[model samples]
Target chain A: MTARTPDSARDIPEATVARLPVYLRALTSFAEEGTTTCSSEELAVSAGVNSAKLRKDLSYLGSYGTRGVGYDVEYLRYQIAREIGVTHDWPVVIVGIGNLGHALANYSGFRSRGFRVVALLDADPTRKDEVVAGLDVRSFEDIESIVAEHAVSIGVIATPAIAAQAVADRMVANGITSILNFAPTVLSVPDGVGVRKVDLSIELQILAYHEQRKSIAPASEDAS
Target chain B: MTARTPDSARDIPEATVARLPVYLRALTSFAEEGTTTCSSEELAVSAGVNSAKLRKDLSYLGSYGTRGVGYDVEYLRYQIAREIGVTHDWPVVIVGIGNLGHALANYSGFRSRGFRVVALLDADPTRKDEVVAGLDVRSFEDIESIVAEHAVSIGVIATPAIAAQAVADRMVANGITSILNFAPTVLSVPDGVGVRKVDLSIELQILAYHEQRKSIAPASEDAS
Candidate 1:
């Protein structure tokens, strides 16, 4: 799925890079639906962003659109995927085969996109030999050997908050530099290591903020 | 847990609001460590942001810091929590008692923060008698009754992608205004209904992007 070469790869903003995969996903959907071309406005609606911002994001990848014909869906999809390095599948390790780890292992989205779960490790001895999503759960002590075998650079931490930092330390010691942390605790990592946390409660709290506003506004307006 | 009143609540940016929970969590951690006060730099390092950005974000909530005294950790924590409306517990409903739903129901972070799971519903009849995270798994048909009983405004969709839209439609029809979708699909809802997607694959893809860059840069530089 790799492209010839990426012309404007280095200077993309972090925010824009974060949104490129989203644009790529939207474009892939359009291609699957038999759409050949789409204007920025149409793609923006599908990507859930405004057309102007979409144009700015796309421009960072290089000029791929026709003057009036808009973008070729398949071409744009490949470009963004290549830009995001999803063109080549990356082997990953998941530590802590708990409920969240089980869900992540069974997640079809990862394989469909660009990630391959090469190993599933758990600290519990009972989980050893258990099969999940076609992979056998191994002892957490096998992390170094498994990471060396697969040459995995990215790791997922689904362990408890208390165990998260310890697992992260082990992963980093074994040369894993990129981590996707699901634990609620904040991890302290050395420089050049990338950590992105996905907290389920944080998302709900943000929604609660808006929901509270909707409930309070009417009453306050009436009183005023 | 509520505060006196929130100043400049209406003018806070969505980005800042989203980060408030992160900041609040960091402050709570500091308070737990017996720390009574912290400078913006210390808090920013703990929160994984720059000190200047953290200061600007805190400024939007209110003037809570002194010039040289730094911020009172407990006071700032409560103010941010109140501003984000997490001081009041929010009743929530979970649809799909599958592996993901089971994990979410058992997730202690939700209860410790602001969310309370009132009901767990699934479409499968076999799962009705099952109990997860101490809550009985009810039938999906009970959605309306459960929602009405709990007055739940927020819903979680842990169903498969094929069933996500139908579940969302039913949720919206039953008066759910905000949704946290874990399903790997884009949901279409009526205007004014908020949808926040937490895609496990998207986060992995972002990390892969940076990981890819690190792997490629040295090779390219050597070639040049």
Candidate 2:
């Protein structure tokens, strides 16, 4: 193996990439509580990860922490924020005005972070009349115009499985580059488009898998 | 590492575990279309994973595929479903009859994948009479009774920030061991209780973080 460089995040594994957000959230909470610095062990305990692994993960972005001292909470938070791209706002349009869409539209997390939900869309013309989360649910026909108007590069698809592909196709066609699919289906976007799915059943099944393991193993472990 | 054993899934990594559902969904689509047995490349394309990684992931699952003939459709499907612990019905409860909870209640994904939402709960007594997803949105007080009646061990909390922790506390107190939290706030759950969060904003923040990198990079080789 080659010696890893100081400023190289590229070498960080995907598992670490996924955990960065968790750490970021933990740091954000700490910052809220007026914490200015935190050791790896402290951060890991709060973030529910191992201390060594936490240090290694942060080492990928650069040595943000001091040897034997710890990390400057504010500075480290800013670096991660910059690294993750929440430094600036990324306008997102949520397509689908169903129950999920309504929750998303009302969610303040997007606006609080770097994401801004600029549009709420639905295919049914009847839905256009309903007001959700203070935004009128518009027809899906206006997706292109709305996306173009807002310069939205990211899109959220909370539509049903039947409409997921069509919505994805339209989003990709409209030049939306990133997608967060809440639909329980496999979406096929072009090569450059990034897609992440948040499936409800999958998570449950995963838990059930572990639950099964716990049930089957009555000894040789913490069994909790 | 020692030579990996064939026909075993204990060695599958967490990353591979997460993607199994994606592959299973893809396979389901193919099965519905009357396709039998698919090569790794075809399965990879459908699952949106690289062929090599897909092979590695499946290899950890078992030698379900013939060396030269590819994977047997029904056999692999059953193996994966059983592996995911979804081959049996898993009863679930969705608390918070708000939009997201309603969407989850209406989603057929859970129904098809061994999860059945047995109840919907909201803390506000006003929502008790409200109907969502063909089921009555009951008071949050119903959690204990519903869990006992339905034998529910899994809980989905789609409540607002204020109600999330309370819901989780009540669920855990009532013997629910697993949680899929949709609230933006960080939830503190006791040990032996599995909690996974799917934040809409967090996903976008991650994408935005990468998207911002795209705009700021003058010239760099980092692809994280």
**For residues A116-205, what per-residue lDDT tens digits would candidate 1 score against the true structure?**
999999999999999999999999999999999999999999999989999999999999999999998789898779999999999998
Residue pairs whose backbone atoms clash in candidate 2: A84-B209, A85-B209
Q: What is the TM-score of each candidate against the true structure?
A: 0.90, 0.86
Task: Give a tens-digit lDDT track for model 1, residues B66-91.
Answer: 99889999999999999889888999
Best by lDDT: 1
Candidate 1 deviant stretches above 4 angstroms? A1-8, A218-224, B1-10, B218-224
| lDDT for each residue of candidate 2 in A144-183, tens digit (9 for 90 to 100) | 8998899999999988888999999999999898999988
Pick the DockQ winner: 1
TM-score (0 to 1) for chain A, all models? Answer: 0.93, 0.91
- lDDT (Cα, 0-100) at A122 in candidate 1: 96
Clashes of 1: 0
